[model samples]
Target: MKAELRGLPKDLAEVVAGHLVTAGMLIDDDPELAYRHAEAARRRAARLPVVREAAAETAYAAGHWDIALSEFRALRRMTGTDDFLPVMADCERALGRPQAAIKIAKEARHKQLEPALAIEMLIVEAGARADLGQQPEARRLLHQAILDLDDRRAAQLGLPAARLYYAYADVLEQTDRPADARQWFDRAARLDAEGDTDADERRDLLDGMSITFDDSDEDGSDEDGSDGSDSVEGESGEDESDEGESDEADEDEADEGESDESGSGQTRG
Candidate 1:
């Protein structure tokens, strides 16, 4: 508000400041109200680029995809910036215009964006692929995104890492690979310390849904043809291993060591 209201009359700046403050306060817990506040600010000072940006992001948070898209385009025009491309493409996806989303992504791919924004565009493109019944392509896109992050200075991709692993796990679950999905979900859970995702719940659900099988010889015999009680105990013990803990620990360290603190650019609700 300070910058955007720089040339405004004192009374007008005060009103806009109040609205923007209220919008920020409610954005996380009451997005509809926050959007209303943002709208008030936008209406009061429609010519300010920052005010328009606030309106676009608030509209997105409120699930008003069309309005968000329009405002984002306006922001692009005002600021001559391409950073908002991911959110714009995502709006296209939400509006069931996946082909349009794909076109936007293609055009933005070669443009220079921050790493976090780049990952967001990649995710939006992958989601658009899913919308087109191209789950394999979507999975492939996410998988390559993870590999790309690993190939780069991994220490700079914190937000993207969490989102990539979580998205990949979701695709794997949809493809009926629950075990692999569980592994990636665990990785995502460890990386997402802010609890931005439902990773822990997903992993817990997978654990509860898992089925245990006996690998003993037929006739209910162990290796030596003894009663299968020992085999059952062994299988139960196998389930009791610290594998999950160790895996989470290792992945957490890797995530912490490699990722920068930059946030993912998407507006979430």
Candidate 2:
């Protein structure tokens, strides 16, 4: 990045570099602020690929999809690589142009991309298919992508395996295949050491795991038990007695309340 900035006068380059550094620092925790920093850098160094890439990423993180799409498009043109296509397609998807996203993914498929980028493209394309109500086609696309990947390499290469599995599980759940979805969510959770895909939470949800809150009055002076406790919270007898009934209620609530995002974002390598 510093090398790219060498074209500018020394003082100007230092200022732009500082903005890029600040953007990178704030991106994960405060994306809007990060985007402001990145925009500051881009305004001064608009011709640099590194600056454009920073701007594109911060915009994407801040949920400014149109600006992200435009900046990523500029990065592609300047860098002469297809590295941004997956994210660009995703930006198109976010803008409610699923067909445009699919078209970009189609173009991406013919290009020689790295393994991770290829997987991201496939994932984005599958999502676009789902958005268009082509659930079966979406499932097939992700299924084939998973099949084509080697499991060992997926684990060792630090690939987006968890996201892939989570996306598949999400589709299965959407399609009313709870049993299959749970299985895939379990697989995703196993690979998701970083908790990137919320797979563990999803699997627990499918398993009907939940906490039962004691809704007794805060005065701690309600409910009946053989023991002299104010509430049933400490009554192991009542809890044990109601265990089976509680399980049914939990399952019902899980079914009605669980909502999921599409999938994890593309790994920002």
Candidate 3:
């Protein structure tokens, strides 16, 4: 077994060494540092497809979009495989070319990438469409993504599910369906909360819904007061009671806001 291992290729050995170095840098929370290691590995194993792919991924994570795109493009040309298409799309999106990203994502889907990855590409396409104000196309893509998730046997889990629901909520909100958006936001919040994934993001979504509810209440109250003032000549008991309740609610909201601020300060400290 030792002799057989020793006979293993030098190129593979260099690639493995690069992976280890890159992984170490990644573990240190330094993507830029890791990217250097990956680049070195890519240089040493230029003919190795896996090394190029790893280098591209690390470069992308390091926010070296130009380098990542170049590496991915090279890999695609060399292998003629769609495996790197989504990564290319991500690079394009980061570079503010959402339409290009959408196109690449579609090509990835055409190549029949994994269902999960395909769904992600669809989500990206939808977001790009939405950014371009193609609301109908965005909604259609989102609906298809939801249907795909529903048909899957595995229970939707983790960041992907959270993100999908969040995206759906955003689309609903953009379409002026606050009630439906709130439902989807609630679902996303619950999923993220349960998974312990970026609890602050989930909290923000819930807080936004709370603010929306407060705004709706205020608008309704103002409309009712205007109608009552026009119809009645004097201050009424019902109006007095409504004013008292509104004052209480405002005080409660103020207290909650203070508590939230205090909690955030403590967390930061």
Candidate 4:
């Protein structure tokens, strides 16, 4: 269908097709550029629902949450399909409207969406609930999603699984469960390792683990200086050097005072 559409010689078709391909190429490397292409496509073919969807996706990828939301809302009205609900919910979550995300996800769930999409909705729902301080509800939702995925043998959705784990880790961290958060983060890292190897994803996962371990070491050191005994010893050595300097200054002052007193006595005599 895409190839047939691209084969058309009409100026609108050419512009739309060109922009669509360009938008996809720019999505990973430069989402802002992708958004521009998608916008161009929309301007060229305002009547095309797919063009609008592309624009919404590009906007969301570029972190323009408001623009993405507006485009998605327009698309939703035009198509009345639940295909983009997960992305819409993600935009809402990013914009700090977690409750709105939860509502959207609930609608998606009622529509009997695809398993991956449904799981994504559940993840967003959990996140929103967590943000609103509904801890038990959030946990229940997350656990339900996890169990559903497990039953479905959805490790095939490794990327989404990794994202879900990272989200769980974020929530745990916010709730002051650093140890548990680290475990989730570790899971995310392992999942990423097992999945596709995009350069950016690999770098992010590796860096995340490195930072986590570094932070753990720092925290452990603070709790029990045994972890940083070398650092402590070095600091102690510096302190001793400062004390020795102070002692030398005190002796120098005493010697100066004695010389002044002796000179005064000699002059008086």
Find the candidate with the highest TM-score and give its number.
2
Q: Which candidate leads in lDDT?
A: 2
Instruction: Please identify model 2 stretches exceeding 4 Å from their true place.
Output: 211-269
Clashing pairs in 3: none
Between which residue pairs do clashes occur in model 1? 155-258
User: Considering lDDT, which of the candidate structures 1 and 3 is the better prediction for this target?
Assistant: 1
Find the number of clashing residue pairs for candidate 3: 0
Which of the two candidates, 2 or 3, achieves a greater TM-score against the reference? 2
Alpha-carbon local distance difference test for all models: 0.78, 0.81, 0.63, 0.68
* lDDT per residue as tens, model 2, 1-269: 97999999999999999999999999999999999999999999999999999999999999999999999999999989999999999999999999999999999979999887888888899999999999999999988888877779768644388788888988988887777888888888888888777898787666544334554545563345323332222112233223345545644643554312211211111
Candidate 1's C-alpha runs over 4 A off are: 151-156, 209-269
Candidates 1 and 4 compared: the better one by lDDT is 1
Evaluated at residue 53, the lDDT of candidate 3 is 71
Better of 2 and 3 by lDDT: 2
Tens-digit lDDT string for candidate 3 (44-105): 66666666776887888889998999999998888887767767887887888888998887
RMSD of candidates 1 onward, in order: 13.2, 8.4, 12.5, 16.6
CA lDDT of 153 in candidate 1?
53
Candidate 4: regions farther than 4 A off: 1-9, 194-269
Specify the poorest-scoring 10-residue window by lDDT in model 1.
259-268
